[model samples]
Target: MDCMFKKIAKQGGDIQFDDVETIIGPSVKLEGEFQSKGNVMVSGVLIGKLETSENVRIETNAQIEGDITAREAIIAGNVHGNIIIAQHLSLLSSAKITGDITAGSIAIQQGAQMNGKCSMVATVEPKPADVKQNAASVMQDTTELL
Candidate 1:
């Protein structure tokens, strides 16, 4: 295991890929969506979505041009679309992301550059009742001030 994987695993992430089922090498350039049930390691360029039930690792030289959905993700490259991780998302110093992120939890290194909104999956959804109650409370406060 590399230092990056070790760090992610230590942080309670699902990034242990002892049995990687998919590997996109650095020289490879793929298009279209990629889906898998097991661990995926990408060191190439992918021009479409990536969906996996297990961990997805994007290496330093890798680049992804579309969204990513995974159980967990460790990114050390460039990503141009949204990322949704069910467990955790770790962005290394070399990572550069340009889209929104929704994750259970996230860790970003000092030099990582991310330019989008980030929301925790557990808190992103607003309950209808809460919204209605908030609106009612605001209306009541306004009426009292008038």
Candidate 2:
């Protein structure tokens, strides 16, 4: 295993490339939507949306020019679109990201560069009904005081 894999293991996660169902080789260039239910690894250039139910790995020298949605991701290349990771995201030192990110958890190395918004998926937003109930309760209490 490489240092990146070791780091992931230390963080209590495992990504096995041996089981990867899709691989975009370094010399290949793709220009359309790519969807997969299993793991996907990219070592080339992709210019469209990437959606995967399993993990996605972007290796060094790779570049992606569209949005990505995955259960987890490890990025060591360049990405120019939004990234949504349902579980976790790891940005290695070589990563250069230029769009928003939404992830349940994220880990960025010291040299990783990012230039957009980041939202945590673990945050809980109150439902509209709940907010309305709380507001009404507050109004009732104020009226009682009056």
Candidate 3:
């Protein structure tokens, strides 16, 4: 908490977190799944899944190449995977993302570059086909007719 300790693998650092804020140092590389119950800030290279019960922030110059799921996310980096945010998603000016995204709300900055599908909704419902098949069975009244 004093000097902001950096991750060991990188000379600079990979990720940083505190009671309220989290920072991912520049250019550091991480090769594994990451899960957090609090907010997270990424400013390095991550090659795995990222999940957070709280908000996730990806700063400029960061690169994440895996699935990300969170309550909210702010991306200013480069991501090459699917993202599912339960609450909100923000793409800042320097962000470059190439993956599908689903969130309750979304914002993309002027200079951001995203090449993927995006969906906005409070909750994700099952596909219509999946639901329709079940409906057909429910209408079967063989027992009642007998």
Give lDDT per model, in order: 0.87, 0.87, 0.76
Greater-lDDT candidate between 1 and 3? 1
- Scanning candidate 3 in windows of ten residues, the lowest lDDT window is 6-15
TM-score of each: 0.78, 0.78, 0.70
Compose the digit string of candidate 1's lDDT tens values, residues 1-146.
Answer: 36533535537534686777898988999999899999899999999999998999999999999999988888999999999888788999999999999988899999999999998876434347989999999999999999
What number of backbone clashes does candidate 3 have, counting pairs of residues 3 or more apart or in separate chains?
0
Stretches of candidate 2 off by over 4 Å are 1-7, 123-146
**Candidate 3 residue-wise lDDT, 24-78, digit = tens:** 6685788899988887878788999998888787877789999999876778789
**90 Cα displacement, candidate 2 (Å):** 0.3
lDDT of 1: 0.87
Candidate 1 pairs with clashing backbones: none
Which segments of model 1 are wrong by more than 4 Å? 1-7, 123-146
